[model samples]
Target: MFIAFAGLPSSGKSSTARALGRIMEAETLLEPEESDWPLLVQERAVMGAFTALTWFRTVRVPKLFRAEDKRTQGGSVIVDSYYDVLIGDYLGKPAFNWLMPTNDPYFDAASAMVREDWNRLPKADVLVFLYLDEDTWMDFMKKRDRDFDRSAQLESHFEMQELMLQASRRAATEHHTKLLVIEQRSGSPEDTALRVRDRLEEFA
Candidate 1:
């Protein structure tokens, strides 16, 4: 089945999605980062964000390329993304843009374009939500210790996480995509993977 890893930043969706792909023998459609994006992730930002932007652009190539690539692959075909708002970045402060609903029309339009493109695809699949509570998320972010962030940015990141959850729910409910919200505690990756794998099988 087609699968998507959705969550706030640092929720471990990408890591889990990648592992799932490997275990299930499916092709992994990695998120935009480190590889290429139609635009850069503001070259000055932290490397992680820039990497993600780079990866996202590669996914946007013409459908023919996407379809062709998938043909050579198998398994669940998991796609990784923060599912964060497109407008949030342009209109938001670097540390807090995610909290905004992104009223910018063009950003909203770009989001529409992405959703439409994915929904129209023949292999569209479930939206897997990897959720973590705010405090834990703060701890996770702190561990990464990006210079752009500090204690002051914690509240905003938490707020952004809430908005992302809402957006993901909307995507699943309104767009006919499946939703799997995995609220996990800090722990081993295998433990988390097994928990999710069970969930996947339950739906199967």
Candidate 2:
């Protein structure tokens, strides 16, 4: 199963994915440039551009990248991304938040880009949305130490978190796929992992 974990940056998606993989001894594939996206966005911001024409190069481009890279790797391939979000615009997020500058020109470009990626995603097996309350979200974001992130972004994240939760509700009804909102506060990694593990198996 291509288990994709989705949420805002620093919301513990990667942390949870890695932990789950370690516990299950599963294979995993990651968006290799994730660590650099924040810095890249900051670098582009100062120059007034996103420089994301490169996203056109998804590892699974052409919709036939490789089942083997995932399939033969192990128990299941877990991934972390801001994509796979349960929204009409999930595909446009990296662009909206990281690319387009909220102009007609940018909006038009983003629309085109969204349609393309929407075509690429398979009927995904499972989507896990990691949610934390406002205080917990801020705590985790601060701990990561990304200098460009600001309070305004956190406010915007607050909005997206609500929107994504709503989106998850819609997806559950529309697609009837598993849309688990595993809360990430309240305990240790091991504690949280067990709850997530139970949900994953129901879908897997």
Candidate 3:
């Protein structure tokens, strides 16, 4: 079994993924670190180059899936932020222009190339989306106290978060995978994980 957790920033994805991994005794793949990619790739702001890197990282997902499949032989694997992150953060961004662009040959070519491979990536058996109402999400963000959390424009952030949630839902439906939406405003991480585990039991 493979479970991928998707959500906006500060929406409890990392904590939920960790807790569920513990509950299932599954191997967990958290979000990839900056060190996981080449430094040049990390520095690139060129839309085409960034888009290509996103696809490159996405391609590695299935390999990890297969490796864990063999290791567990049928056990669960919990992914903190899988392809949905790419979709929400990169592909969904108009600024990134990953889908289509006018007059930029490289961007168009890269978009097509990545889209082809993106469609080939395997869907998770269960995609769990963690979200909160705007007020709750804002409160969580304020508590984190990150630099960006303090400095970035909240209006834009809220718009993007809502877009990402919608995109996640579409992706789950398009892939024909199981979708679980957990509201992260009312419980502790363990409580949410227990609820998720109970939901997973239904699929068993």
TM-score of each: 0.66, 0.74, 0.72
Off by over 4 Å in 2: 33-40, 46-50, 53-75, 82-99, 169-176
Residue-level lDDT of model 3, residues 1-204, one tens digit each, is: 878887766787778888888888877777644356554444444435545455556655664466347445876688777543335335536533323344555655555654764466556778888877888887777765554334334424655556666766766777676888877875678888998999889998
Prediction 3 global C-alpha lDDT? 0.65
Give stretches of model 3 more than 4 Å off: 32-72, 84-106, 147-155
Candidate 3 at residue 29, lDDT? 73
Go through the candidates in order and give each one's C-alpha lDDT: 0.57, 0.59, 0.65
**Predicted structure 1: clash tally:** 11
- When sorted by TM-score, best at the front, the candidate numbers are 2, 3, 1
lDDT string, candidate 1, 57-111, tens digits:
4454333245335655743466665343222222243434432234533445555
C-alpha RMSD (angstroms) for model 2:
4.1
Give the Å shift of residue 28 in candidate 3: 1.1
